[model samples]
Target: MDGTKALYYGAVALVILIGISVVLSVISAIIGLATAVISGIVTLAVLVGIGYVAYKAGSWLLGDDDSASLDSIGTGSSSTSVDAGSSRQDRLRKQYVEGQISEAEFERRIGDELETEEIDDIDRELERER
Candidate 1:
């Protein structure tokens, strides 16, 4: 009777071990499949991005005779020069209005900007044009 009981227990343990191994194998396979699918999607996105850049480059190089497009290709800055001091002053004014900066700090920054040479040159140029 003891021998039969031992055999039954051993068989149950073996069955449990086999079940656990099967479950683990299935989980590992699912993870592998998911990783492969995600990798494929990421690779496809990168290829599409590269293809778009190449297409744009080829179009720019081989497709146009238009002067307007060529003029815009590498020249991105505004034709008219802007006064950095005035822009900074405007930003400071906005910040003061928004209560982001103190009045004294805003006033000091505006004073500093007024003393800059670029602003002086811009003012002179404007006066000359006028």
Candidate 2:
């Protein structure tokens, strides 16, 4: 599924298609069939060699993680954790919203509970500011 494997597979498929096309073309040719077959075979062999080289190059560029976990992480399957300070802040906010604490007191206490971890851009911390 990664670029390396994709390139390798694509090269292989291209070689196969080209080989088939050359064979068919040779069979339909009006000239010497033997010469055509030889030419076709040589072309096919060269294509296969090129495909192998391309496959090796791709593997060198992309590394050897067949699972491609790094690629998948960006697609929303990764897990994230909230630090203790943030969790405490969430609890405080809930209590403040429910009238368990005054607005002024909530502001002071929440402000004192400094965040200990980096905030992700997707996490709307400004909502907590309100």
Q: What is the TM-score of each candidate against the true structure?
A: 0.47, 0.27
Candidate 1 error regions (>4 Å): 63-130
Whole-model lDDT values for every prediction: 0.78, 0.73
Return model 1's CA RMSD, one decimal.
10.9
| 10 residues in a row with least lDDT, candidate 2 | 73-82
TM-score of 2: 0.27
Task: Itemize residue pairs with steric clashes in candidate 2.
Answer: none
Give one digit per residue, the lDDT tens place, for model 1 in 11-53. Answer: 9999999999999999999999999999999999999999989
Task: Give one clash count per candidate, in the order shown.
Answer: 0, 0
Error of 2 at 79 (Å): 12
Candidate 2, after superposition: displacement of residue 64 in Å? 23
